[model samples]
Target: MWKFILRRIVVMIPQLFILSVLIFVLAKAMPGDALTGQLENNPKMDMQTLMEIKEKLGLNDPLYVQYTRWINHLLHGDLGLSYIHQQPVIDILAERIGNTVMLAVCILVLTYLIAIPLGVISGRWNHSWADKLIVGYSYTSFATPLFIFAVMMLFLFGFTLGWFPTGGSVDIQLEQGTAAYYINKMHHLILPSLSGALIGTVGLIQYLRSEIIETKMKDFVKTARAKGVPESRIYSRHILRSSFIPIAAFLGYEITGLIGGSIFLESIFSFPGIGQLFLQSIMQRDYSVVTVLVMISGVATLVGTLLSDIILSIVDPRIRIE
Candidate 1:
């Protein structure tokens, strides 16, 4: 497994290089840099001054020259400076990525915790009342827009009932590192996390339910039933395990996506997370931040694919990677 992972890592080198090139080129291609936008807003700044500013920032360099410098900095753990924030891109990311990771991880665990057993029961029951209820839940969540659901949650739970904070990740007034501070942070996260999880669980439920129902029709399940296997044992020991292969693969990709957060969801909740930061940087034309974020997302996608392979092999003994 270690050797296999190492081999996969080696394969990813070229892919990463390609991804970096695309990300950098595309970001640079976006018309107008931060300096241009800033200078335009300040009408007094003459074209010559703008040119001088661009030159100082090396924005006037050739594409190849800029890319070579950017890639070299990237290879050495330097993500460059954020044009909008006037700070290192990594520094800004360090401040925001944790919030996104924490929220995303909570959403992921909650989504699966609620989705898996509910899916199993729904599939096992097939056409029963409980199955209908779970199906209804999945459908409702599917139909509801993420932002609409997030807004409804914020209004009902946060604004109306006053059960949770309306927005933001924590109460800034509270003393950091204190027990109360942590509790308050969790409290603030509840609505957003639950909102995201509720929306996310729909696909998982559908996937698991369909897989389970399909698996039950297989000859092995019928053979077990014919051999006098207990219904519980057949479903628990045989069917449930077999049905998880696709779901595991699905979850591997799902985990990587959490790092990006939902722009609508995070924006609605005023959550200080990577998604919101990405949107802000884009509006401000922060090339460094935008490119690095895309690079990170690209890396995550590659890692997610690798994880899917590993998970598929784990869930199904027949799968092997050389």
Candidate 2:
């Protein structure tokens, strides 16, 4: 396991380097940079002032030189400065990464809670009403756009009935620095979390259900049943463990997808997370922030893939790493 992990870490270095190059190139190819947007916003600023700012920010350098400088700074633990905020990009990302992680955790928990049981039940009673219901849920949730779902939720809870605040992480009234504040924050989190979770649950449950159903049809399952093993024990001990392998792999990809998808969801909920920051950076054409964010997302996805491989090895020892 240690050797496999180390090997994965080694592979990630070049993978991340390639990702950095891709992100940098894409950012450059975009119609505007931070400077372009800045000049547009502050039309009063003359070309000479803009030229000075560009020089200071190394935007005046050749693209390759600038990329090399950025890579060098990354190796030295600097994420560069945000052109818009005038703060270290790492610091800005650090502030919001936690919130995004929390949201991810919430969505994951809710997805698993809803998906696992539905999947198991669907598998257990293959052609029954429960299976149909679960299938319906999976299709509907998976097919719906997250932004549209968020909008519908906001309309139902916020605008039409006024049951919940329209947007934002929390109400300012609960800023008394007490448990009440935290509780209110959690309350406000419910809608956004639910939106993300519902999106995830549909896919997860369907995948798990398919895996479970396939496992149930296998020789081992038939033999176990023939040998008079209790159905519950067979399911709990054998089927669940066997079916989880595929589910685990799917979950890894889901982690990466969730972060990527959160951009729209966070904006809809007005949640102050890394996704929202990413969107803001894009709007402002903050190349530094954009590159850093792209790198972060890339790293996360690579890590998820590595984790899935590691877990696969652990679950089935036949997958020994070379």
Candidate 3:
């Protein structure tokens, strides 16, 4: 397992390099840049001043030179400056990433807690009313768009009922570190977290239910039943255990989504997370911030995939990493 993890880490180096190149090229190729947007809005800005600003930003440099400089700084833990915010890219990300991580963790926990057992039960009781109800819920949840769900939730819970704040990570008026502040923070988290979790839960439930049903048909399960193993033990030790392999494998992708946060949901909820930050950076053409965020996401996805593979290997002795 350790060797496999090391190999995966080594493999990520080249993938990260390629990802950086693609992100940098695409960002540069975009029609408008931060400077161009600034110049457009400030048409009276003198050419001399514009040239100086471009030089300062290394905009006049060759593409390779700029990329080289950016990579060098990145290796030294400098994420460069956000043109829009005039702050270090890392700083901006730092402020937002915690919120995104918090939101993602909440969504992940809620999704698993709600989806897994329900899926198992639905599969075990196939054709029953409970199974039918779960199936209906899964389909409905999957069919509904995330943005629409978020809006409806906000309208119902925020506007009409006023049970929670409509948006933001916390109430600005609340004193930080106080009980009111933390309570308000959790209150703000509920809608956005539920929005993401509901969307995620549908797919998980569907997958796990299918896995459980399939695993129940395996020869091992039939053998266990023939041996008169306790029904609960057979289900838990054999069926559910085997069913988890596929779910564990898929968890990698889910982890990536959770870390990145849901862009539409975050935007609708006005949550200060990496998703909203990414959107704002794109609008402002803040390539430094955009590049860092993309790189982080890509790396996170790769790591998650690796972790999933390791977990699968651990859970299923039949599977081995080369």
Candidate 4:
């Protein structure tokens, strides 16, 4: 297992390099620079001063040289300086990535908790009233746009009943680490986290339900039933245990989506996270910030896929990687 994981980690380097190149190229292709909008707003600025500013930001460098310099900085743990924010790209990412990680963890936990049991039950009674209810709920969540649901929830819960805070991750006055701080923070997170979890749960439930139903009908399941094991034991211990093979695999694939999908959900709630940071960088055309964040996401995807493969090998010993 260690060898397999080590090999996978080694392979991620090239993937990250490609991801960085793509992010750089895409950012350059965008319509404006960090100073474009600023210059537009300041028509009084002289052309020479504008050119100097561009030179200061290294916009005067050849694209290849700029890219090479950026890559070198990335290796040296300098994610390049943000042109708009005038801060290190790492600093900008550091400020926001934690919030995104927190939200992602919450969504993952909520998804597994809600999806597994609901899916198992739905699969157990595939044609029953419970199944119909689960199906309907999952479909509804799957079909709804996350932002729209967030707005509706905000209006109903925050505006109409006034039960929850509408936007932002905290009261803005809290010092950001105390218990009181977390309480206020979590209260604000509920809506955005719920929005993300709801969408994830819907997809997980459907996938798990299908996998479980299929697994439960296997020959081993029939043998377990024939041996007169208690129905609950046969279903839970046998059926679901086997079903988890697929569940783990699904989780590995969905890990990327769990993080990437937060862009819209976080934006709606005004949550400070990687997604929000990515959006801000895009608007400002901060290529350094965009590069680091995309690299992060790319590395995450590679890790997730490799982890899934490793988990599958462990769960099913018949599978081997050499």
Let me know the TM-score candidate 1 reaches against the reference structure: 0.95
lDDT of 4 at 157: 81
Error of 3 at 182 (Å): 1.7
> Each model's TM-score?
0.95, 0.94, 0.95, 0.94
Candidate 3 stretches greater than 4 Å from native: 259-261
For candidate 1, write residues 85-198 as lDDT tens digits: 789988898998888888988899999999999999999999999999999999999999888999999999988999989889899899999999999999988899999899
lDDT of 2 by residue, 144-239 (tens): 988898899888877898866667776787766799887887887787888888877887787788888899999999999999999999998899
- In model 1, the worst 10-residue window by lDDT is 256-265
Candidate 3, 50-160: lDDT as tens digits: 889999878999999999999999999999998788899888888988888888888988889889988998989888999999999999998998889889989999899
Candidate 3: worst 10 consecutive residues by lDDT?
A: 257-266
The lDDT of each candidate is 0.89, 0.85, 0.87, 0.82
Query: Candidate 4 — which residues are off by over 4 angstroms?
Result: none
Best by lDDT: 1
lDDT of 4 by residue, 43-100 (tens): 8877788899889878889999989998888788888788778887778888887888
The global Cα lDDT (0 to 1) of model 3 is: 0.87
Kindly report which residue pairs in candidate 4 clash with one another.
none
Model 4 worst lDDT run, 10 consecutive residues? 32-41
